[model samples]
Target: MSGKKCKHCGSSEIEVDPARGDAVCTNCGSVLEDNIIVSEVEFQENAHGGSSAIGQFVSAESKGGASGFGRAYVGIGQESREVTLRKAREGITALCQQLRLNQQCIDIACNFFKMALSRHLTIGRPANLTQAACVYMTCRTEGTAHLLIDISDALQICCYQLGRIYFKLSRKLCINIPPTGKCFFLYHKVANERAAT
Candidate 1:
């Protein structure tokens, strides 16, 4: 494409076949390029005369798909755990951004969520509750000037419910979070004053 011409016939008309991994010159009927690498997924014809994809779509964040945590196939109208986790992660990120938390806090919250997921603690629990608890844990551990009530208000959930989940998540994860101190409040006040100016 960058001023390339066929050596055999000096023709610039070329056709690329990604599936065959070759580029052919249209005018001269000669191979212009070969042994090209393709990243696309291959497909095959099924017995029912329909084309089916050859592989499953695995996410970079998913460690469970290849580890046999569960089957890769999901029935119709159902979703895989990886999809659920991805959605939960997006929700966590959105909530953190809305609260104007730093990236470190968001990363820590996602890590906590993953840990809770691996431990099977998220079973029988609401996804939003788990997400809120993870963010609260991040705030506590990272010494961020955010409170459970603040997170509850952002999520529009009851503060009591969020508090219960936060305590339970911390206990289950064996994380001993320090109580909110006067320095944290002062830090928030100073940060707000600086931002105002």
Candidate 2:
């Protein structure tokens, strides 16, 4: 502590939450300071010799790194694109969770979304719709019990557009994921769980 004390309560007891970048007075439970700027760069050599803060901190998502979940790309629109991509990813992840999918299925749906982006399939489409369509496609390909109309209702995506994009994506990607068999869709609950119980 740089001999700095909380101005609110004049207390030395202060806490810093690095994740949220907030410094608070523990005694008064008041915010001492918010948004502490953490510079991304560790060191940099300017046009000369002295070290500077010009290079970025290489996150632990590189190959052979500890974070096997990898990094989520937010794309390159500064703030707007980052927010939009994050929302899309959240939508896909949430929908997969609702479907009671495993991590592998969620990963597959995320990949489908990424593939759609790379294929420029998102150019004239709503991001949310594309995101849900990706998850729906993954469930179909994996032969899960998710139905198209059900996914459409849950995600609030238009059924016709969703089906259209799904078929086009399948054709373009050469993915022949047949629609799930009717027997699998007979129940609205977890099929195997219900059977076992």
Candidate 3:
């Protein structure tokens, strides 16, 4: 099933609750169902007052729970939702440190990044460099505008180092991040579409 967006936060944090037959937003604890779907899909007004919350999806597959995205390792495993969420939060926080993103944005971005990478990469634990690249690419795609130089500085490496990271991640993930100019074109296309009726 497709991932549902959150009604309150306009985040794609919705997950299906089999018991309730409704999709619930894990980010803001919002229940999105029925007629609320229309408003939920609308762009939420934030300080930026734009479509900052891109229409994306968050599925159980993204979290390695199902849809055959990634397999959970038992070296450290949990059977409860609380523990899993805590672990995910912690991992995301560390990844944010690497990517220079704030905590709140990191969780959601990481969710999407992992899913996209899993859809293309081979089965294996990605290296730190690969993870850093995925995080950087994600931030760029999500409109963070953080420069690669700034990201490299935060990672305590040269700008070229992160470029290498991005390249290696692209190789490992088997997904090519389009050129910046191409990405700009695609972004404008989406923006224009959003601007039109």
Candidate 4:
């Protein structure tokens, strides 16, 4: 019942509902204000015989606790590891699709990328390079007909750069890629001979 007058009926009589956190005008039956802050402080008893505030200010978009809110915002700083992994997965998927690779190949490529992330091999490296390397590794391990040059062409990057990442990733992961077959060598030799002619 403060001296605040209601704009609807100019009535000075207003009742504040603490439970609903609102103020209403009694004379005109109009809601004056809502979401009013109440001075009541709530607390909970802890196992240590201490009292603490009842609830915390949880952000609706934060996925920190068990409340299952949502993903937290990165907010004007370096991206988090999860964000980087997500981007890498997307990039790897796109590159695999561009190569017309099958689902199994895509899945294996994603797994390779995940393993690299788990081992922290992707740190301080371009995400696309890591993605391309993972895809190339998948192609090799899955025995797909794709070459490193195909991935490099799809990503529009230098083959040497992709090759460096590919070799580094293979060595770090201890993956033993199969050597080129005799037919592949003969084909390459014939192609080179034709070009020389």
* Regions of candidate 2 where Cα sits further than 4 Å from its true position: 1-85, 185-197
Candidate 2 Cα lDDT to native:
0.69
| RMSD of model 3 against the true structure | 20.6
Question: What is the Cα-based lDDT of residue 196 in candidate 2?
Answer: 77
TM-score for each prediction? 0.57, 0.52, 0.36, 0.55
From the highest lDDT down, the ranking of the candidates is 1, 4, 2, 3
Clashes of each: 0, 0, 0, 0
Which numbered prediction scores highest in TM-score against the true structure?
1
lDDT tens digits by residue: candidate 4, 102-137: 888888888888888879898788889999999999
- Candidate 2, residues 65-167, lDDT tens digits: the string is 2121222223322333345556777888888887788888888888887777767777787876788778878888887777788778887768998888888
Candidate 3 vs. true structure, TM-score: 0.36
Q: Write the per-residue lDDT of candidate 3 for residues 1-197, one digit (tens) a residue.
A: 26556657978866764423356777887667521111143344567765433223224334433221222222223323334445545654686876557766676545644654446541353344444565677666566645566556665656776687666555655554545666655666676578696
Full-model lDDT for every candidate: 0.79, 0.69, 0.53, 0.76
Residue range with the least summed lDDT across 10 consecutive positions in model 4? 64-73
Candidate number that wins on lDDT, 1 or 2: 1
By lDDT, the best candidate is 1
> Which one wins by TM-score: 1 or 3?
1
Q: Candidate 2: TM-score?
A: 0.52
